[model samples]
Target chain A: MTKPAFIAVDWGTSSFRLWLIGEDGNILAERRSGEGMTTAAQAGFANILQAHLDAISAPLDLPVIVCGMAGARQGWVEAGYIDTPTSLAAILTGAVVVPGQSRDVRILPGLAQRAKDAPDVMRGEETQLLGAIAADAKGEQIVCMPGTHSKWVRVVDGRVTGFSTFMTGELFDVITKHSILSHAVAGAADMPADTTAFEAALKAAFEKPQLVTNLMFTARSGQLLHGTTAAGAQALISGTLIGAEIAGALSSAGQGAAITLVASGRLQTLYEEAFRSLSLPYQTIDADAAVRRGLSAAAEAIWLKNESKS
Target chain B: MTKPAFIAVDWGTSSFRLWLIGEDGNILAERRSGEGMTTAAQAGFANILQAHLDAISAPLDLPVIVCGMAGARQGWVEAGYIDTPTSLAAILTGAVVVPGQSRDVRILPGLAQRAKDAPDVMRGEETQLLGAIAADAKGEQIVCMPGTHSKWVRVVDGRVTGFSTFMTGELFDVITKHSILSHAVAGAADMPADTTAFEAALKAAFEKPQLVTNLMFTARSGQLLHGTTAAGAQALISGTLIGAEIAGALSSAGQGAAITLVASGRLQTLYEEAFRSLSLPYQTIDADAAVRRGLSAAAEAIWLKNESKS
Candidate 1:
């Protein structure tokens, strides 16, 4: 029987996913829930972890490795940050042990760019970056991890030079739900996305990224004047935001730096369409897989390799 | 007592300001209320107007000239729009009279740029432009009316070549109120404005308008990493939005076009500070007086001159 060697968890701001990994480094059992850092702060992170461990009837002494906001200042424990420009491999060794835990539990540190002019911080994405890029990767790489706060990281010779966080997804959610444009996109949730409108807006905003806000207004005015459908309005908003994001992300990038998009599902489709519309080339990496690989690396470095040596 | 020739009303989305104008082109009496288009739509636009009119003990035969959202399709009456590439004076002739009213009531038409690529519409600001710029004025002028939906009009030889509406103010409102940044800027309402942060962010966003969204995230990150205050976070958001707006507004303007800023109170102060910080020369116009002058123009065209001729 292949026994579970360790536990791996990705505990983000609003989501939680765990996997019991065997000695072979494959996922043997899994648990996913809404008990992320936000919820866990109130529900008790240890109790939640124990419940999940008991659900799979894992060994009592099995070690666990966690990443994401669970290590935030307000989360279960403060894992702190590893300042850039640092190697991706540095994060694996920066994992902070969860004190007073029944089992050996560790949470990985985040990445922070403390430049006075362009300060930035990211928790789980640092781990994802570690898994997405090889430790010995050479050349310039522009890695885009799109989500609520989309992160665009500039890496050279496997070192994180800097990164920018675009409030793309969070802005979209607020604008569509709370702004006057809310009226323009009210009934577009169930309808198929208007890709034509999306492509046009994406191209326009990419070329003139400064007019992004004005372009957003067209979602409402276009509906009022040209009778644009709700789906078209929604698509226009999404495309405009994502387009400006891409332009900004690449504004300071090295010429011909390989664009690596780390995303999955709807964001993947949208970003890929945006890049294709703008004729910008990019390679795709599944975000879920990348984060898992990152956690696994930390797990192996912290437990598996140590056990084998012992 | 000066005879009240007509009433000039700026019936906007959330505010109502009416000036009883005498035949001498002076305000005889004034009334202000929160019963704007939104509240008036539910309470009945006619009743709200009548109450204000009755409060002043005005004659039953007094006529009314209204501008703003009251002329919107969802307002008092469907006043329709005068398409762009037309003279500024064209709005005066496009007023639609409300039928079945006790007194004569006219709603001025808004300006609409029907171009497919950059469709836009403005309801009340056309009248403001009418008052802000002379009919026979020559050369190029860039008129910026900063409000909920900031309007930037490009006028060449008194003709509105085109305009764009930047969702700067509304985006700021929604982002600060409903987005994750809300936590960053909490309790900022009473705090004094952080001019230092505002100027820094404004300059940054202006220089790299494409990075507006990314710049916005720095407000939160700055707070977390550098212990920036709530006031600073709020200022950063405001400055970024306004800076991006200014960059986009001037993207296609003629070289050295005169910048005319029509705003009042807080908005006027903020925009003036922004222009000064950017070292952009601009002339100021009082928004309240401009709208009044605009509505008075419509009144003279629609009723006063016609009645005098009769």
Candidate 2:
């Protein structure tokens, strides 16, 4: 029986995530904090890490692997991203080793893809794709990870081929909060299970794709004339946003790409319903389950990689 | 002949404007400054007003009639707006008089519709619209005034029937600065003459009208796939923004209510082309001309109202 040898971190804009795992891929403990990259930007990285690290009374020598914004320009270490159409294997295999004062910490570099056909940059998803392939181990798999920036990652033979990112969450915030659509949305309400608006909007999206801008006036106009409330307006906005997301994801991956959507909560149902309606074959995986699983797997791989050298 | 008994001020978010007119409606002098409401917010209203007045060597004893945010709760004085379908006869007739030290200052109220129906509000436009109506005096007409918050004013029989405001400028800023669409947009390029992209986007807007949200994703997808650079992307963003503005204006005014577009400089061609393509009849009045006429008209109304009292 081996003690936990390493921790994996998924540091995002709003939250800091930690996963502890043994050499034999098993989760030992986990921690989280509001001290994410954004907060850490204000509170300095060293203090945040020290405060968060206090959660574990272990040897400070434990090797740790960090992902996400923790590797970007403002993150803990600036591990530059590699460009698009990159593989997880390439990322994990090529991840820059970030040395911490008290421990051996490795921060992964995000990919920056600029090609004739595709131009995009991605970070953090590469490690997860590596872990997902390590777990799924099937043939070519397209992983659709949804968040502020939704990524459609292509993995072939445990290697990341390429991926595209849509600034879905950011756009959702802008359109809903600032655009004419704000009049349409209220505070978050439970999405209708059937997602009637989502389906209609998606259908509308594919049919008359240009309505994106024109339909905006209706958010306010409907209320002005037709007496549409803000809540109903919000639904229409959500539907429109999801519709755009679906159209972009479908076009990026193209038809026949079996999409395994790693999602949960409200977005899960919306994406599930939207993908199902598109006649696209997809499997809905609990995002949280995959998150820890992916984290632990990366930890185990890193531990082994270091162990072999030792 | 009443030498201009007062100066009328139309202060907005980005620009400060003032006009001095004789009792006979002759434009005596006019002044312009970048120190508008938002900028003025930092400088303290008294300083902004005094500085501008100081620049023109305007008489402190001359009373000033002001419209727009300068009268909001955050402004120099909270001159409350009158409800509409209410007329300028009512607003002008119902103007609130603020007694200042040396000179009497009055800030005219903007028009507020059901905050729910359109959540639209306007300030300077009420005075400007009155001027447009004063210029024509044919009584009731629709004045389409375009700015960050585009207004379509209902002038019924020499009085303001009602008006609605749309957040076009703010929407343009958010889309270009924050939204995924920003990837495609140029940094504040002047609207090209008969900008093909702008025209096409406007057509796309009115074409489906309902699927507007779906269309936004293409701003990113287009750039990603077809090498749509920032300028072309910006054109699309502008197209979408203006298209939405046009849609909002059209919807508020309903189909074909005679409209006189109050604008000048760069906005003239865009508005003229948009209205023409939509088959919505409109005539353009120079922006400065309208502002001058509006200031003169407001002054005349104030003088008349005061004389009636005296």
Give the best candidate by lDDT: 1
Residue-pair clash count for candidate 1:
0
Judged by whole-model lDDT over C-alpha atoms, candidate 1 comes out at 0.92
lDDT tens digits by residue: candidate 2, B1-310 = 4465577688886788877766666667778888888788888777777776777677767878777778876677777767777656556655677655467777777776654423455677777676566533764467877776667677766656556555556667777777656646754365443366566767765653433433444456566545665666666556655676666556655664688888887677777888887787777777777666665555666666556421
- In terms of DockQ, the best-performing candidate is 1
Q: Score each candidate by Cα lDDT.
A: 0.92, 0.66
DockQ of predictions, in order shown: 0.92, 0.11
Interface root-mean-square deviation, each candidate: 0.4, 6.8
What's each prediction's TM-score? 0.98, 0.62
| Single-chain TM-score of chain A, each candidate | 0.97, 0.87
Question: Candidate 1: misplaced stretches above 4 Å?
Answer: A307-310, B306-310
Model 1, span A181-221: residue lDDT tens: 99999899989999999999888888999999999999999
**Residue B185 in model 2: lDDT:** 70
Name the top TM-score candidate: 1
